[model samples]
Target: MSGIVTELWPYIVLILVGYLPNEVWRMLGVAVSHGVDENSELLIWVRAVATAVLAGVVAQLVVDAPGALALVPLSVRLAALAIGFLTFLVIKRSVFAGVMGGQAAMLIGGYLSGVSLMVP
Candidate 1:
């Protein structure tokens, strides 16, 4: 129905424009990695590069956040990051818990810092 299509348009667009493109590459990677040795030097290098990229992104977000995230004090962000990592470890390495903990910490810290969501 037109109503259903209209309501779901954004989700449909997201699947087509965002999810599918990335998923294809993920599937291709899985297919190609089937016979690859996990301990191979090439894989190790790839892992290291991936880790470095992720670390750089995290560092950038903390050091120079964009939009509303920038309103958060650097100390609060740093504390949130640490709390998130500790939550991850304390929760037996559950990434979901870590993310939630980080998000919660950020919200609490931001509130405590008197950051109004609507900054005139």
Candidate 2:
């Protein structure tokens, strides 16, 4: 209804505000990739900033967001991340080990939290 649309329009706009800036970088990366070298200083800075931003977003989601991350407490989520990092460190940065460890922790913690994950 028009009333519902009116109420939600501001939130929709706010979502796009966060979305557009990331898209700009995505488009720029695609546009610039052909001419750039893998070892360029600019590329290194971009990679670092991208990693930091992604980590920050993931931390925020683990701490407060619902859906996938809402099944467990913040402490459990942080523990999972720490475990994943340690697994990566110990295994010489093996991606599969790191991913599986984190996912196992999240799934086990989520199960222990009494959340009905089957519903979603």
Candidate 3:
């Protein structure tokens, strides 16, 4: 037991230091948002801010992707994003379908580009 904890100490620290800090604000937001009107102006503003941030991050990843993601072509990345968004709209705003569609497109691109995937 102690040996396992010792080996996993870094992971435990990361959860406490990284995840916990961000999760606390999310939890607080949920708590505060309770009973608030979902379609209200405040919520709309929040959604807009979140969407803008997400778009910025996505744009950055597509334009200047780091590490393995950089291997995939920009055109392929853009295509995958488009396919995913189309799938989301077609599927009645199903986020799962959108993500799966995007991932499938990305994997297909990776295969076509000769990038290797490891299977355990």
Using lDDT as the measure, which candidate wins?
Answer: 1
lDDT of 1 by residue, 42-102 (tens): 8999899999999999999898999988989999999999999999999999999999999
> Which model is ahead, 1 or 3, in terms of lDDT?
1
Tell how far residue 12 is off in model 3, in angstroms: 15
Q: Order of candidates by TM-score, top first? A: 1, 2, 3
Best-to-worst ranking by lDDT:
1, 3, 2
Give the candidate number with the greatest TM-score.
1
- Residue range 58-120, candidate 2, lDDT tens digits: 888777877856757787788888888888889889989998888888778777877576765
Q: Count the backbone clashes (under 3 Å) in each candidate.
A: 0, 0, 0
Please list the C-alpha lDDT of all candidates, in the order they appear: 0.94, 0.83, 0.91
Deviation (Å) of 108 in candidate 2: 1.8
TM-score of each model, in listed order? 0.65, 0.61, 0.60
Candidate 1 matches the true fold with a TM-score of: 0.65
What is residue 41's positional error in candidate 3, in angstroms? 5.7
TM-score of 2: 0.61
